[model samples]
Target: MSMWSFILLLISVQCVFGTSSDADETLSVMEDDSVTLHADVSAIKREDQILWRFGPENSRIAEIYKQNMPTYDINERFVDRLEMSIQTGSLTIKNIGIQHSGLYKVTIISNGGTSEKRFRVIVCARLPIPNITRDSSQCSSSSYCSLLCSVVNVSAVTLSWYKGNSLLSSISVSDLSISLSLPLEVEYQENNIYSCVINNPITNQTTHLNITQLCQPCADTTRCGSAEAVIRLVVSVVVGVATVAVLVDHFRSVSDTSPLVP
Candidate 1:
């Protein structure tokens, strides 16, 4: 056989007897949440054995074997917070933390043969609803207004500004903190609306700003506040004049009824 034909046959043989793993399988969970990684096995025979491994080096995490009856064992890293099913070959991790994010591999061996599947887990805390606060000191219609987007109890996140579906500005940080902020400035206009979005792999939050509400000419003249006060002053003056006229009429009536002294 030619060298090219020999290489093609070798590739087909590897495809038939490979470790049989998938890399794109993904699972996401929030910190302090519980998650289960499926083994994709339906049933297991009495002689079948299952091994679950984690990390890049494939450190053994848990296993199920049939020494006498169905037996289960887990490494010290996951001894107290893991559950493995012998029948379905599923692994459940409880109270998962951000440190638990990694690659997981499960190998199932039975009378048929050995098959393996892999999963990539991502665990992160969900950021709270982001707040949009206008910086009036830097805000004006002649130039631009500075807006601040922030959230508490979150770190290692991304904050961004979006006008409709298009991205305007974004910031990302690797360090952690209790609060994070992203500042952006846009020209003052009453026709467009902007949004502040904070996101992570697991979740996201967003808030919106209406330009009409922020512009000076539009907000200050929303039917005008001083105009309403002027109307009230005019109403009070008319009421006071009517009241004085009634009191004068009452006094004159009393004076005419009084008897004159000789």
Candidate 2:
């Protein structure tokens, strides 16, 4: 074979087999957003054939041939969500969802040879704001307040507690959608800033804690002084009313027993 012919044969062999594993690109996108699997070619030639396969099954999902219009699989799995760029052979998935997260491969075939590209897509759910609540079971203590930071129906995320810029505690889940909670203990009068955060690879949400507001009822402290003051005020009013009633009754009895007034 001639030198040019040998080069063409080698290129064709690589394309037929597929791209190298290290060439696989990883993309992360939030649910309901669009993701484009780039062909990485400068342009698509008129006689080139573009094909795309998806998932571990390598199911053919889209194709374009010889300057003809692109077509997508009629499978309900894709429906109207797939689009292709005729000029570049890149594929775009609109309003992507968690079910669509998987491997994707694109092959471009031409008279000279062929080229291939692979991609791994990760679709993540929106992160919910972490909640910070006082752990009531630990409320009996006066020196410190027990708190919990939590989130529900989350996957591939980490829940964390931070004191100012410092991390206090964290818990993570990889694939399962479940609830997560991290506990923290702080003095009732803690002046340092505290916050709870929940995050995935793409995004994060945080909630700040107000120590005085959440731990205000802890026992034997000024944090409980307002409630105690109210109780004391009520008792004093009741005793004063009883004393006035007794004095009025005693004066009434004396008047009834003494000389009559004009």
Maximum-lDDT candidate: 2
- The lDDT of each candidate is 0.72, 0.81
Q: What lDDT does model 2 reach? A: 0.81
- Tell me the spans in candidate 1 whose CA falls farther than 4 Å from its real position: 1-26, 56-60, 67-80, 136-144, 152-156, 175-180, 186-191, 210-262
Q: Compared with the true structure, what per-residue lDDT tens digits does model 2 show for residues 74-149?
A: 8787889999998888999999876776689999899879878889676777888888898988777467889999
Worst 10 residues of 2 by lDDT: 10-19
TM-scores for every predicted model = 0.58, 0.73
Model 2: runs farther than 4 Å from truth? Answer: 1-23, 219-262
Candidate topping TM-score: 2
